[model samples]
Target: MIASVAFRNFKALRETSLILAPFNLVIGPNGSGKTSLIQAMVQLRALARLPLRELMPDDERHPEGAEITFRFQPPFDGLEASLSCVSESLCDFLQVTPLSTGGGVDDWVGLRARLLSLKSYRFNHEAIASTSALKDGGELAPDGVNLAAVLFTLRNTNPNIFECFKAELLRIQPEYDEITLIEQADHTIALGLRLAEGAEVVPSDNLAQGTLYLLAILALAFDPEPPAIVCIEEIDRGIHPRLLREIRDLLYRLSYPASTGDTRPSVQVVATTHSPYLLDLFRDHPEEVVITEKHGRTAHFTRLSDRADLAALLEDGSLGDLWFSGILGGVPDEQ
Candidate 1:
């Protein structure tokens, strides 16, 4: 898993470094560079496949350029990749390369594939509900499309894992009696939900946004060939507050093995949330929470667990209350 990442002249993150946990939940107000942090990951992933110019187009915010350095933990302890860009708008000059050291060609190749496997999600409910063409599954689409195909594959290939996924989903949403997989005449698949034992299955297109979102997340977490790193933006969107804990747990299960019984490869998760309720869920796991605060044109990232006065802050109120009350630096400045 990526242990840490440092950014310089990258959008709002003029100079910032973030220590990542297996599961990272970044809470901050709008324009606090949360999205930029995720985008940095996306750009890093793109470098493995996309051209430098496409990845680092001239941005008015940072015409000079930017640099992103990533440091990994054990297994890849000494492996590091630094992606830098120097741009000249008039000449349209751009350069990008991964200056990795202490690893052979094979290691770099494997790391590149891992980087390419990093998936960022901002589920598009409509796209997710749309019928998916028949194809081999194991990976969920970035926008959460082709969900039915992936689920169908899981149901057929690994029934046990599918059952586990179903149980988890049902636990989060007990109202749904069962999950249905509808086969189309064109040899495609669509997802549906059964409200009662004998009730008709409601097609995904008709299902609530939260239900689809939850299913998409479960499918991703249960994926047999999961991505190396998963980034989710506004993860609490459309989900009820009470169910937020389940969502948090689900993401946690993706990272730590002790969080769940199922044996699977560790998959790092980085999620951004604007909800205090979701922030409260991570109070016990402050190491996995990062607060983003932007001042002027620069943004700073601070791990909640690194605070020197954490005990006193927790005494002030719940994690969410402190953050919402502006004691946490991530809150917006109204003065």
Candidate 2:
């Protein structure tokens, strides 16, 4: 799991450091640099697969360029990269030259691959419903285009994890009891949802947006071999306010193990949300909430628990209430 992240000269994040938890919720108003922070991490992770120059080119317009550091848990060493020079260091052992030098040292390939395994969910309903078979050993696509194929593979290979996914899905939406896959003539499989024990199956294309999103999330959360971290943007976009709690619970369960025989690997979740309902879900657990505020060209990150004023205000009101009233600092300033 990622313990902390620090970035400088990365888009709106001029200089900021944030201590992350197993499950993190980033709440801020529009253009407050929430997405920028996620993009910075995603870009750093992409370095493992792409050259640094292509990801973060040296442009005179932004002389400072960008640098990011990720500190992970035990067994995996920390990594820091200079996007401007494309230099990288793993702990204190090795240092690599610029990207021009065959993309730095290759000793950190394993660590880089783990970081690159980080998944970002950008739900595409039409794509999620696609019946095309993906290559063997393929993982879930970012847009969820290959969701059916991936789930099919899981159902066939790791039935236990797939069953856990179905159980979690039922918890999120009690209407669905089972998930089925329909084989098409072209050898592709389409996802089918059984409403009840013997109810008529609903095709993936016919499923609700919220249902599809929840399925996609559950699949990632319960995968036999889960990613080190997952970044989700606008997590509450299609879901209803009442169901946000369930979604929050699902995320919490994925981040930490429960005593109910959930042996799946713990997967960290970093999600961005504009929904007050979602913010309220983290009221008691303020440490997991990171509030972002943009001032001019720089973005600042602060944990809700780190702010004494916010804590005091919470004595009389909820976190969402404080944020909506602009006491939390992420709201728009009305001059």
Candidate 3:
């Protein structure tokens, strides 16, 4: 798992570092750099897949150069690299030339796969419902457009994981008893929701937006071979406030392997949300909550647990209440 991430000269993140947990919920007002932070992680993953030159941003503000440092949990070495508009290079400690062979080359390859597996999901119901079969590896697209296809593959290859996914999904939508993949005569595949002992089957296209979003979220959360890291933007977008606690519990269970006794690697979840209900659910685990604030043009990140004063205030009220009251820094300035 990623222990921490440090950024320098990366858009709104002029200089910032965030210590991550198994499950993190980032809360911030508009344009406070919540999206920018997530985008930086996504860009790092892109660098792992594409050429560094292609991934680097063409910004002249950071003349000295930009750098992103990723610190991983033990047994795996950390990575630090210099990035620039025209060139990019890895730190000497890596012991490998950019995209070349060396002592740390194998480690780099492994890290690359881990980084590349960092999937970001932003619900797009129509795109998700229209998905066809995945080419291979059952990888869902960043926008979750291939959600149905990926879940279909999981149902066929890893029935147990699919069952777990179904159970979790049911908690979100108790009306659906089972989920099945329907293959059309055109060879395109779609997800079917079986209701009331399979009396009726609702096709993917016919499902509600919230249902589709929940399916895609649970699929990523419970996949047998889940991505190393999953970034979710506005996790509470379409869901009701009352169900936020259930979703939060499901995410907590998925974030740790020991919780589910699953042999597969644990999936780390980093999500951003504006929902006070969602923030309230994470009150007991302040360490997993990150608050983003913008000072001048730079974005700063801090875990809620790191603030002693804030922890003291939680004794009197909920985190959401404190956040909304402007005691927390993520609240928007009236100006």
The reply for model 2, stretches above 4 Å from the true place, is: 50-63, 76-79, 85-110, 134-137, 258-265
Best by TM-score: 1
Candidate 2, 164: how far from true, in Å? 2.3
Better of 1 and 2 by TM-score: 1
Writing each residue's lDDT as its tens digit, candidate 3 over 1-335 gives 67777867666676788888889999997877788767767767766675443333345334645566666654344444433322222221111133332233346667667888888777788887774854532787766777777887888899887887887787667887878786667656777888866569888889888777777777777777778888889998778888787778667666876775666767789999999889998777889999998876777898888887876798898888888998888877676
Model 1 C-alpha lDDT per residue in residues 182-294, reported as the tens digit of each score: 67898899788888656878899998998888888888777877888999999998898998988887887788756587677788999989888998887788888899997
Model 1 lDDT, residue 251, Cα: 83
Cα lDDT tens digits for candidate 2, 188-274: 878988887569888888999888887777777667777888888888877888988877877776787563457776778899998
Q: How many angstroms is residue 49 displaced in model 1 relative to the true structure, after the best TM-score fit? A: 3.2
Model 1 TM-score? 0.88
Compute the lDDT of residue 290 as modeled in candidate 1.
92
lDDT of each: 0.79, 0.73, 0.73
User: Model 2 misses residue 46 by how many Å?
Assistant: 1.8
TM-score-wise, the better of 1 and 3 is 1
Score residue 291 of candidate 1 by CA lDDT.
Answer: 95
- The Cα error of candidate 3 at residue 211, in Å, is 1.3
